[model samples]
Target: MKMKNIKLIGIGLVGAILMIGCTDLDEELNDSVNEAAGFSASDLLAGAYSSMRELQHEQDILASYVHSSDELIAPTRGADWDDAGAWRDHHLHSWTNTHPHIDKTWRDLNSRAFNAQLVLCNGDASATEIAEATFLRTLSDFFTLDLFGVVPRRACNEDLLQPPTQQLGRAEAIDVFISEMEAVLNDMPTANGPITATQNAGRMLLAKLYLNKAVYKATGQDGVAQPGPYTFDPVDMTMAINHLNEITGYSLEDDYFSSFTPTNTETSTEIIFVSENELGGATGNIRNRWHMTMHYNQQPSGWNGFVATADLYNLFEDGDVRRSTDIPGLTDAFGYNAGFLVGQQQGPSDKTLTSLIDLEDRPGNPLVFTEEVDIFSSNERNGIRVIKYLPNLELSADADGISFSNDDAPGNDYVFFRYADARLMKAEAILRGGTDTNGESALAIINELRTSRNASMLPAVTESDILDERSRELYWEGWRRNDQIRFNTFLGTWQAKADASPERALLMPIPAEALATNPNLTQNSGY
Candidate 1:
């Protein structure tokens, strides 16, 4: 099959496809878009955001490696996990030369990027719409780099039409992403012509670029998880720090939970970038899996699948308030019925249940104990249900309509980059190779996140701690595998998971199609 660069279609065209009345082009001059000329720019943007949701779903499956050990998946029907679960297959055992999501994700990201490029390259996209679109594209490339290390950097739709060459290696792709990001951020049009809109102030594209510089700049050829030829550049660190510090008019919400509810999107200060979800709009159910695990009984609970890992739960400190955010036993927020409860099955069983407090009851329930049951493996319930992205209010959580109610799903803007993440990256940089010329060390920066959460026992600010904090704060948001590789942990063993297999699982064995298309594209080290 020929690789179709579908994203090359311009905004006017793509918009026309998704929305019925959004086209600005005249039918005579552009008869191709005449059918879709009625589509709105916002609707076109919504279609682009759908791709974002797809990418997040793929990443979330991989992030489960944190607690997917024997302690977690054994009991839950995740038994077929090897064939059924994402962890046992794609991540844990490294089933190279077969997994298809890797390619699908790239294809989705490419499509999203192409759509954004279309908007920028064609039609009269308003400044706000263009800014949002570019932010989305930058995000797509940023994640693409994170996953593949080095990917083909194509900004123009025209670039995709050309016959492909060898897929670029990790280092080359890093440079490309950096250059593209620099261009994207600089070209980020204001929310308005002269005056920036307050609603658009918190976009996270720039901050994420700065946060991942060290990983991006560090080059490596081998895929089995050893330090590569890439050298860490302090100048890159400085530039990253500068970009991070430059984002203005955003602050952390004192109540961490405030940053996630549908209503919070409008007033939350922590949101750096949000994919606006209008009430009753499309693509609103992206977070159903997480919410269903905790709210299935409260009216439909919307339960289908997905849960949290014990490793992440263990990351919470004694007095840390964040734990209550989704712990085993807490109560409703205000008067609502939300919080942890105990007495739930960890996995499926042939035996009959004497109590209602089985797995069924456990859904939408919280923990009363400190321990998480390993349901998938032991047939015992051993993990906490995730509640992070579920909108706090019932209407916001309702499955009846699209995820974001016409951008009305409260204003819990998705935090692509925020001060906490920035500070953590700075800390990691220091631990890796940063200096204290400004009187700050990796330890100091790490403590900021710890202290803010009122964490009493802090780990020594080292490379390990930095990586650990990243897992704790940025888990499902996507960054686990990259951190594992850069810190040299991918090949090592951890929890119920390990890299003891025979082949290299390093750089997702160059996507199957790419290998068939380009001879220069060799498989990553271990595959």
Candidate 2:
């Protein structure tokens, strides 16, 4: 689990986000962060980047993105995973503005934006620092726009005592993001690995922005925004393709799970941008990818919180690499696989771990993961678990010399962007009415990816095929919601979530705390 030191800084925020009173004179933290910064350019830049580390964890931001979609669910398993119905509301699309997860995500993302902007606002920042900071700020804004349909902004030296007055609506935010990112693209250096900000990473963001422009451009009520049955402009699609074409120096990994392993930075060719994690650094809990779903009696005992839906499991055939398969590192002596986990699980010394907790349906029996799951109430055996990011078992109890445990941090760099997703976006652009720059047909690109994944080739491709392919390739990567939203299938009923989501669900409600602090924020209507 080695990485370039530049990519893995101590996860600590170089210094505290200076606190101030929100009085007639003092500028408080509630309105802005890094308001009274006197830190070095390096310290501020590193701090800016460090704020993103928390994104890799589930139960909040990533959970909201995934559990709201059809691919994942956090069913109430008897006494565990019932967080006051927070997980269930996400799956059922009944979340209010005050939803803890939604509120936390908004604050976390805003902090990221503020820290990056402080670097830009600082007089000492070099050109390279500015470019990287610009990318970080835009990335934070893009997420805010996508999730909440608005982004609050304080100018370069806005008064800290006053709340943020500028609120960029979705469409306007899109315009500013494109302009800012494009302006700095050439200033950033090419990255040695996916960890550092680079021109290619900037291009990837541009590609995403262009592809989703039409959706953001949709004008309607702030809260009850219309879910897309919208148009994909050929111009925007072509722009998306052009930006994708500019992204270089990455390729699809032949071994699909290698892209997410603990040593992925050394082994994988697919990663384009990642939140670089360190064994004893970075704030993100990457181990939760496995720990969130696995049973208490499994090899590395877990909280048994969430699972992949049966509908998503049914999408794949037996031979696909993306489908659950016995992984070399993860499938240790006890035998666990990389993707969707089902059937009886094994623990230490090849023991079949039994359900220690008295689950309603299967008490004192083998810890078997059945396909059936209900959000309101379920047993430990009700849902098929997933393990996308596998831990480095060399540090496990079995290994000699090196020491590790479930409590120790895992050095799995959480994926933010990968070449496979970019390639898929290119195919999506072509399907949406753009001609491929390299004369690559949509079917050819689709089939080519399938061949790499060991899945059967399709005779042709359609929008549905593209969406399904996205599901298979990018499952459990915190992108299912964005992909589902882009494909216009997000609101549709599926699996444990029986009812179709409302149009108002398209935009998560602006948190009440934000409204109280900033006069610019308008709550999305349904809340």
Candidate 1 wrong stretches, greater than 4 Å: 1-51, 58-87, 123-135, 153-166, 190-207, 210-231, 295-305, 326-330, 333-380, 395-413, 435-441, 457-460, 498-503, 513-522
TM-score of 2: 0.91
Tens digit of per-residue lDDT, candidate 1, span 333-387: 2112222222432321221211123234343444232244433453223445555
The residue-level lDDT of candidate 2 at 407 comes to 41
Please provide, for model 2 over 1-527, each residue's C-alpha lDDT reduced to its tens digit, 9 standing for 90 to 100: 22333232322221112111123423334323443354676677877776687676675556767888888989887778788888888899998878888877777777677778778888999998999999988887888888888887877766655667688887778888999988988898676577778788889999999989888888575534567766889998999899899888778788888888877877898888888877656537788888788777665667888888998899998889788778754465535788888887765443322222222223677677889888878887879988888876654556443334534577788888899999999999999999776998889889989999888899989999999998889888888887788888989999987788878788888776667666667787667
> For candidate 2, which ten residues in a row score worst on lDDT?
12-21
Q: Pick by TM-score: which candidate is best?
A: 2
The Cα local distance difference test for each model comes to 0.47, 0.77
Candidate 2 wrong stretches, greater than 4 Å: 1-36, 221-224, 350-362, 395-407
Count of clashing pairs, candidate 2: 1
